[model samples]
Target: MTGCGRREPIVTIDGPAGAGKSSAARELARRLGFRLLDTGAMYRGLAWAVQQAGIPPEDGAPLRDLLERTTVELAGDRVLVNGRDVTAEIRTPAIGELTSVLTALDPVRDKLTPLQRALAAAGGVVLEGRDTGSVVCPDADVKFYLDADIETRARRRRGELAARGVDVGLDRVREEVLRRDRQDMARSLAPLVRPPGAVLVDSTSLGPEAVLRRLLEEVERVRCCTPP
Candidate 1:
């Protein structure tokens, strides 16, 4: 909902892995007529590049060099790195794991966080990521911390994998989700946290559409409260 003769509001969605941030952010952006900034995909694209170049996670110099040369672009639903489309390539469990580690590093966050801010500088974007609300867009007009029970989250992730034809056991997926949660919350640089004033939405019992509707309601509430 763009305001006439006023800047569009910036919305941030932050949550742990498997919490349905991606799907919610996409639909929310569509309904609001705003751009969807999937920050996780950007990190995954970088991780995929690192994996392909054979760069170890602990190696800082090489990672810095790669960051200097890399160009990550979000074109519609596709993700491109250095002019190569890696949308499908970056969604694997391996990239997810790597992305967790790489994103924790200071260099990685330092490199990407600015780009994320620049993308949303105009203020008509929906940014979704672990740190979008806490770090990337702390002053966003509206912020949401979406979450769900671990069991529900794991099952959702498993279903997503199944849809992609990459079958994985529930137990393994649950463990992976736990591990990512620990890493995301424990990381020193920009660790995941609910931003001040962010509205929390527990999706443990809510479906995607329900969560989207809730977010829309909150956004509308914020918009109505703000002076034109």
Candidate 2:
């Protein structure tokens, strides 16, 4: 994935919740010297704004109105909505649930999809989200559908919450993970699917370093095959 005199490739990593897409995307971007686009954070930022404005989650009118006036910015690791920092605020289980629900809405996707594309327009970017490959960047140079066993994913989610000092039981976390998967797959608009031409990476037993190595290998393989 060297840039040199050619355009850098756009890489997309898409998968269900707790599949380690975020961590891998960040590290892969760092290793490749490309910008990391956390599309999930954009939705979370909107969810935080919706909560603050008391906008009903299922109500389209108010949500649309709020989105019309909203500005979600992903600056490094921080997420800002309407010029206010919300990176930490939107990471809770509650906000995550709300984000899943809000993302199923047409108004929300219509509002954010273009922003996501524009951000990756320059080509040197790694985008991670539920639909980054299937919907947001279907023509991305390299796309990966990273997944793990449900049990592994649930444990990962629980560990992440515990690290945040939010202590949650494994059973409860597992249920939440399952619920999110159902919602994501059942959504009418842009349901989570492994896009055409995407390489599937099962990371049930692989560590972060191993996953990064595999992703880098695939990227390099593509780079070699592509004409400059």
**Which number leads on lDDT?**
2
lDDT of 2 by residue, 108-137 (tens): 999899999899878889999999988998
Candidate 1, residue 66: lDDT: 90
**What's the CA error at residue 92 for candidate 1, in Å?**
0.6
- The TM-score measured for candidate 1 stands at 0.96
Query: How many steric clashes between backbone atoms does each model show?
Result: 0, 0
Misplaced by over 4 Å in model 2 are: 1-6
Give lDDT for model 1: 0.90
lDDT per residue for candidate 1 within 128-178, as digits (tens), equals 999988898778889999999999999999998898889999999999999
- Residue-level error in angstroms, candidate 2, position 189: 0.6
Question: Please, what is the TM-score per model?
Answer: 0.96, 0.96
lDDT, residue 120, candidate 2: 88
Candidate 1 has its poorest 10 consecutive residues by lDDT at 1-10
Name the 10 consecutive residues with the lowest summed lDDT in model 2: 1-10
